[model samples]
Each structure stands twice: as structure tokens, then as C-alpha cells.
Target: MLINPTIEQHDEKRRDKMSQVSLTKGYWFFFEHEGNDISMFGSVWNGKENVSFNNEIVSSFRNLNKFKSEHSFSKNGHNYKVCTHMTNMLRGTLVVSLYCDDELLQTETLSQIGKDKPSKRFFSKTFLWFLVFGFAVGMLAGYFNLFG
Candidate 1:
């Protein structure tokens, strides 16, 4: 779904304010085209926003994986590229770089505040095992009732 530019701008500003207030680590990369700031992950970047583009570009954007390490696209007579580099996996250090027409536009290094907790993974595995055990016991009970 396409998002309105005004609403997108508002959300970006709000997120910026919240991050500043809480000192959280977050980053945004955007490009300016025709007096509008289009966020990289927003509707415009995904070719959802209305523009005079043929089907091929739109399809390319639609099929593109935003999480990939590198991407390059051209829209509205401008070339854009996004590159994500993993500096440290354990520390969650990421370097996001943006380039316009072969010129570097912006680069940001972002890191998570704390280490990831494994409790959620552990809980999910345990729950799956519990369900399997319960199902096995239920099947055994049904067999005994039918054959005994």
C-alpha cells in the first residue's frame, strides 16, 4: 500500500523525536525528488507512489529485496543505490550507505543498544516439543481405548 508523503514525513519526525528522547538507536535513509523526500523503505521507494514510470521499473522495485546487502535502481532520471555492510554481527553494527548517480549521498553507522536474548527461541522450541509429546500421548490413549 502506498503511504502519503505528509504522513510519512510526520512519522519520520515522530520517530526521530522518540529516538532522541529515549536515546534509542535507529536510522533512516531517504532521497529527495521533485521537492518530495521519499524514504527508502516507504511507499515511494517500493514504487508504490505514483510516478511516470514504465512497468519494468515498478516490477523491478516490487521484486527487489530491501534487506539485501546491495541494490541499485534508477527512477525519474536519477540513479540510486543502497548498500548495507555488516560491521559486527554480535554487536549488531551496520553501515548503511546511499548513493545517487554514483555519488555518495549519505552513510550511517547504526548499532543496537544491547545483545539479543535467546529466551524467545528457547521458549518456542520447548513449546513445540511439549505439543509433540502431548500429541503422542493422546494418540497412545486413543489406540489403547480402541484395541484393549
Candidate 2:
């Protein structure tokens, strides 16, 4: 869905619990645009979708990737929105940020955080530690002649 480009939701029902996540993961912005001026911002990003409006989609070249897009529209008023999305494909976690003239308007992060790299990092670290500990134990046993 083309969510709001900014945080000012005309309806309260549209508000989300992202006042905190936005600080670390995402941001939104809104601004006024007028006549022939190259607006600084207003964007959107959709990774799964190919047809993005008023912007481009950029990939991070990794499964743990980010998507970026942006554009603006206005003849004499604030009439545009832009957003970016960083999503972890392995786990369904999403981070989206929107902007206008460098001003933040709204941000949203999927509450269901995706799986972190715990599996890879955890297993690797544990295995390495185990190997080190085993080596030390074997050396001690050898010195004490306990394994003979």
C-alpha cells in the first residue's frame, strides 16, 4: 500500500506505535513545493513491487537488504511524499522511512521483528569457543597424564 508520505494522518486510526523505532530505524518528512523548484525530498520504496511511483527502487545486493525511492509533486503547495524501506528478506522485518525537504513526517517498522543473524553468529561463536575450550582441556589432561 502507498502509505502516507508523512506522519500527519487525517485519521487517528492510521497512527501507529512507531515514535521510537523511527529514531533508530526510520523517519518521515513533509514539505511545501512550488513552481519549477527542485524539491529536496518526498519519496517511497517498495521492494516486492516493481512499479513504484515518483521514485526509484534501490537494492542493497543482499538478502538483508534495503529499498529506496523518492519523488515530489507541486505547483504551489506541499504535494508530494517519498519513502524508503529496509527489509530483511530472511525474516519478515521491515523498516520504512519517509521524507520531505529533509523534514520527518512519519516512520514505521514492522512490530514483528525478523530473525536476526543469531543462527549464523551464535552457532559460529559457540563452535569456536567450544573448540578453544576443548583444546585447553586436552592440554591440561595431557600435562596431568589423565587421558592415558
Q: What is the C-alpha lDDT of each candidate?
A: 0.46, 0.38
lDDT of 2 by residue, 32-128 (tens): 2231212121122222322222222222222223355444433234444544454553333445454445666555564223253345664565568
**Reference-based TM-score of each model:** 0.44, 0.30
What local lDDT does model 1 show for residue 137? 89
For model 2 the local lDDT of residue 26 reads: 30
Identify the runs in model 2 with alpha carbons over 4 angstroms from their true place: 1-66, 111-148
State how far residue 35 of model 2 sits from its true place (Å): 23
Please report the candidate that would top TM-score against the real structure: 1
Residue 50 of model 2 has an lDDT of: 23
**Residue 59 in candidate 1 has what lDDT?**
17
The count of residue-pair clashes in candidate 2 stands at 15
The weakest ten consecutive residues by lDDT in model 1 span: 17-26
Local accuracy of candidate 1 as per-residue lDDT tens digits, 2-34: 342333333545434321101122333344445
